[model samples]
Target: MSQSVAARPRSLWRDRNFLTMWSGQALSQFGEQITGLAIPVLAVLLLHATEFEVGLLNAAGVAAFLVVGLPAGAWIDRMRKRHVMIWADAVRAVALATVPVLWWLGWLDIWHLIAVALVFGIATVFFDVSYQSIVPSLVPAAQIPEANGKLESTQQLAGIAGPAIGGWLIGILTAPLAVLATVGTYIASFIALCLTRDTEVVAPRDEHEPLLRSIGEGLRWVFGNRYLRRIVGTTGVSNLFSTISFTMLPIFILRDLGLSPEAMGVIFSLGAIGGLLGAMATPHIVRWIGEGRAIPVSAIGFSVIGLFLPVAALAPAVAFPLLVAQSFVASFTVLLYNIVQVSFRQRITPKRLLGRMNASVRFCVWGVMPLAALAAGGLGAWLGVVPTMWIGAIGGLVSAAFVVFGPFWAMRELPAALEEADADASR
Candidate 1:
C-alpha cells in the first residue's frame, strides 16, 4: 500500500528551498489580498465608478488568462520556471507602482486603472502558472498535499490579515497610497526568489514542434481525459458564478449596505478564517473519507452554504454575521476542494506536461471569469445589487450538479497516474 502523507517522517518546514518559496509566497499573497481590497475601494471611492465599471475593471484583471494562458504554458515549459516567476513578480511590482505615481500626478482615472489591471493580470498569469509548476520540484511527491496545504494556509492567512491592514491603510493613507504595500511585498518576494536555490530538471523538448501544436496537445490531454474533463466543467461553471457574486460583493457591502471600509475589511477577514481552517483540515479529511469522496462532499457544502451571501443583504441587523458566516463556509469548501484536486492533478500528470496541463485547466476554468464579471456588472446595474447576488448564488448552487451527477461521485480514491486511469477506462 502507498504511504500516507501523515506517515512521512520528513517535514517540509526544514527544507530550505521550500521555506524560502513559502515565505515569498506568503508575503506575496498578503500583498495581493491588500491590493485586491484596495483596487475596488479605489474605483468606488476615488473615481466613483459605476457597478459596470467596477466589473469591467475586475474583468480586465483576469482577462489575460483567456488571451495568453495557453502560450504562456508552452513558453514556461521551455524555460526555468523559477526565472519566469521572479520576472513575473518584478513586472507586477512595477505595474502596480504605476498606479500611485499616476494618482499622485493627478493623471489617474478609470482607464488607467483598467490598463494597469490588464498588465498586472498578464504578469499574474505567468507567475501563477510558474508557481504551480515549481512546487512539485521543490518537495517530494508524498509531501505535495502538505506543501499545498501549507501554502494555501498562508494564502488564507493573508486573506484574513491583508484586508484588515488594507482597510486600515485605506482609511488613513487613502486607497492610492495603500497600493504601495503591495509593491513592497512583491519586492520582498523577488528577493526571496533570488535567494532560493533549486536545480530544475528541464523536460526534453521537441524543437520542431510548433507552439500552437504544443498548446493543442495540452488541450487534448486535458479534454481527452475523463477525470480532468469533469473537473474542468465543474470548476468552469463554479468560477463563472463565483466571479459574479464576488464582483458585486463590494458594491453590496459598500454602496447598498453603507458599511465603512474598516467594517468591510473586518467582515472579509473574519470570513477568510474558514479557508485557513479548511486547509488545515484537508489532509485529515482526505485520510478519513478518502480523496475522491472529499470532492463531491466539499462541492455540495460549497453550493449550499454560498446561498447565505445573497441572503445577508436582506437583514440589516444580521448582515455582518451573515456575511462572515457565508465567507467562512464558502472559503472552507473551496479550499478543501482545491487542495485535493490540485494534488490529484499534479500526481496524475507527467512532469513534461505539468505546465501545459495546468495552463490548460486554468484556461478552461478562469477563461469564463471576464465574461461573468461583465455580465454581473450589467446585471447589477439593471436589476440592482441584491437581485444580482441572487442570480449569482442560485447559479453557484446549480453548479454542484455538474459534480454530483458526474463520474466523480463514483470515485473513492484517485487513480495513481494517467496510465492507470486509461486502463480502467478500457475495462
Candidate 2:
C-alpha cells in the first residue's frame, strides 16, 4: 500500500476542477495585462491627459478595494465562492467591452474610462477575493504552496506577453481597439469558470448576521495577531508610495522620454521576467532562508531597489534600460515576499474564515492604492515628477522596517496551528 501510494504522482495536475480554474485564470490574466497598459496608454496618448487626470483614472481602477472590499469578504464567506467568481468575470467582461463601443461612437472620454474602470474594479474586488479564498477548497493543505507558485508563475507569463501584445495591437488598431482584445480574454475566462466544479462545503451561518459584524470578525482576526497586523501595515504603506511613483510612469515615459508604444510594451514585458524568476525561485529561497526570514529580506531588498526608478531620470540615454532594471528587481522581490506570505496565511487560516481573512488582508494591502493614486496625481502636479518619485522612493523604504524588526525574524518554522493543519490534511 505504501509503495503504491508512493508510486502515484502527488500533484494538482490530475485535479480537473483546479485545472479548469487555472486555465481560465491564465487567459484572464493575459487580458488584464493588456488592459493594464492599454487604458493608461489611451488616457495618456489619445486623450492627452495631464498628470492629475491620469491619477484620477488610476485611482478609479482601485478605489473599490476600499469601498466594497470589506463587505465582499463577508458576503463571499456566506455564498459559494465559485459562483461569485463567475459573476464577477461576467461583469468585468461587460464593463470592459464598453470602452471600444464608446470610442466607436466618438463618445469616449476620460470620464467614460474612469467610470468603466470603477465598475470593473468593483467586480474585481469580488472576483479577486473569491479567487484567493477558493484555492483551499480546490486543493489540499500540502498542495497550497505548489498551487500558489503555479498560479503566480503563469500570471507572470501573462505579464510577459500581455503588454507586448497590447502595444502591438494599439499600434495597429489604436488604443480603443486594443480594449476589444482584452474583452475577448475576459469572455473566455467567464466561460471557463462557468464550467468549473466547486467543492466548498458552506458552513452554517445565521442569515440574520449583520454584515458589519462579519466584517468586524475578519478585521479582528487579522489585526488580533501581531505578525499578521505588521505584515498588513508594511504592505499597505509600501503600496501607497509605490502607486505614487507608478502613477507618473505613463506621463513621464510617453511625454518626457518620448518612447513609442512598442518600446513601452517591450520594457514592461521584459521587466516582468523578474517576477517570473522570483515565482519560480520562491520554493528554493524559502527552503534556504525559511519563510519568516525571507519576508524581511525580500521586503527590504525591493524597497532599496525601488530607489533606482528615480535614478533613471538623471541620464536620459540610459533611462530605458534603467527603468526595466528597476521594474525587474522590484517585481522579483515583491513576488518572493508575496508568494511566501500568502501561502503561509492560507495554511494557517481555517476554511470557514478564508474569505474574510483574504478580504481583510486585501483591505489593508490594496486599499491604499486608490488613495495613493489621488495623492500621486496631486504630488506629481505640485512637486513635479522627479520630486514626487523621490518622495515615493524615500517613503517606500520605510515600510521594510515593519518586517525587519518584527517577530518573523526568529520564526524559522510554521507556527503550531499551521503545522497541525498540515498534519491533519495528510491524513
Candidate 3:
C-alpha cells in the first residue's frame, strides 16, 4: 500500500506524448471558438447573405453527422485513430485558411462559407470520433476517467474562453480576420498530433467486409449491453428535448423578456460556467455517489432544473435570475452525466470496436438534434416558445425515467467489460 501510494506521482501529466497531444487539442479547441462565431457573422455582415442562406449554412455544418455518423465509425476501426485525427485537423486548417485568401481576392461568397462549413463539419465528425476512441489507448485504464475529466474541463474552459477571445477579435478586426486567426490553432493541433508518438498499429480489417455489416456489428454491441442500451435511451431522449427547448431560447430571452443581445450572451456565458464546474466535480461526485447511482441522480437533476426556464413566466420580475439559475444547474447535471457515461462506455467496450461504438452512440444521439431544432422552430411558431419549452421539459422527465427508475439506482459501481470481451473485438 505504501509503495502503491508513492508510485501515484507517475501519471499521464508526466507523459510527454500525452502532454503533447493534450496541448495540441487545447490549442485547437481554443482557436476553433473564434471561427465558429465569426463564420455566421461574416456571412450576414460582409457577404450580405440573407437569413435563409445563413440557415442553409448552419444546416450544412451538421448535416454530415446524419450522413456518415455510423459508417465513419466502421472506417475509423480500419485505420489508426491518431492518424485520422491528424488528417481531420489538417483538412479543417486548410479549409479555414482559404476564407481570408478568397475574401482578399474578392472571390469569397456565401457559397464559400457554406462549402467551408460542410468540410469543417465532416472533419469534425471524424475528429470527434477519433479522439474519443483514442483516449483509451493513450493512457492507463485507471486514468481514463481522470483523462476524460481533464479533456472535458479543457473543452468547457475553451467554451468560456473561446467566446471572450472571439468577441475581442471581432472588435479589433472583422469576422473574416477573426477566422484567419483560428487557422493557427488548427495548425498547432496538427503539428502536436504529428509530434506525439502513437503506438497503435491497428490490425488489418477485412477490406471485403460489407460496410453495412460492420455498422450493424457496432450497433449490436452498444444496444446489447443492458446498461448501454439504457444509457443510449437516456442520452438520446434527453438530447432530443434539450435541443427542442434550447433552440428557441434566444427568442425567449430577447423577444419575450425584452433583453439585449449582450444580456442574452451574458446569461448563456454565466449558465455555461456550471459545465466547467461540473467537469471538475465529476471525479469527486462519482466517488461519493458510486458511478451507477451518480448517473441516474444527475439525470433527474437536469430535467427538473430545466423546468425553471419555462416556468419562470410565473414570476417575470425574477425570470432572468430564474433562467440563469436553471441554465447553471442543467449545465452541471448534463456535463456530469456525460463524463460519467462516456468514461463508463470507454472502459467497457473492446478496442477494435471503439470507433464503431462511439460512432453508433453519436449516430443515435446526434441524429435527432437537427430534427429537434426544426421541431422547435415549427412549434415556436405554432404554439409560442414558452409552451414548446414546457413540452420539452416534460419530455425530459420521460427520458430521465429510463435510468432513474432502472437498476442503476440500486447498483453501486458500473460493470467492467466482461473478461472474454476484454480479449478482443471478436467477442
Per-model TM values vs. the true structure: 0.95, 0.95, 0.87
Q: What is the C-alpha lDDT of each candidate?
A: 0.88, 0.88, 0.81
Q: Can you list the residue pairs that collide in candidate 2?
A: none
RMSD per candidate (Å) reads 2.5, 3.1, 3.5
lDDT of 3 by residue, 39-91 (tens): 75576557765434544565567667778999999999888899999999989
Tens-place lDDT per residue, model 1, 1-427, is 4567657647787888889989998999999988988998999878999999989999999999999999988888888889999999999999999999999999999999999999999999999988888877788887878898899999999999999999999999999999999999999999999988766777567562689998987788787777778778888988899899889988888888889888889988998899999999998998888888888889889888878888898787899999999889989999999999898888877776788989999898998999999998999899988888888889988777767777766677888767975554444
The model with the greater TM-score, 2 or 3, is: 2
Tens-digit lDDT string for candidate 2 (196-233)? 88779876675536889989988877876676777898
Compute the lDDT for candidate 2: 0.88
Q: Which residues of candidate 1, in runs, are more than 4 Å off?
A: 1-9, 203-208, 422-427
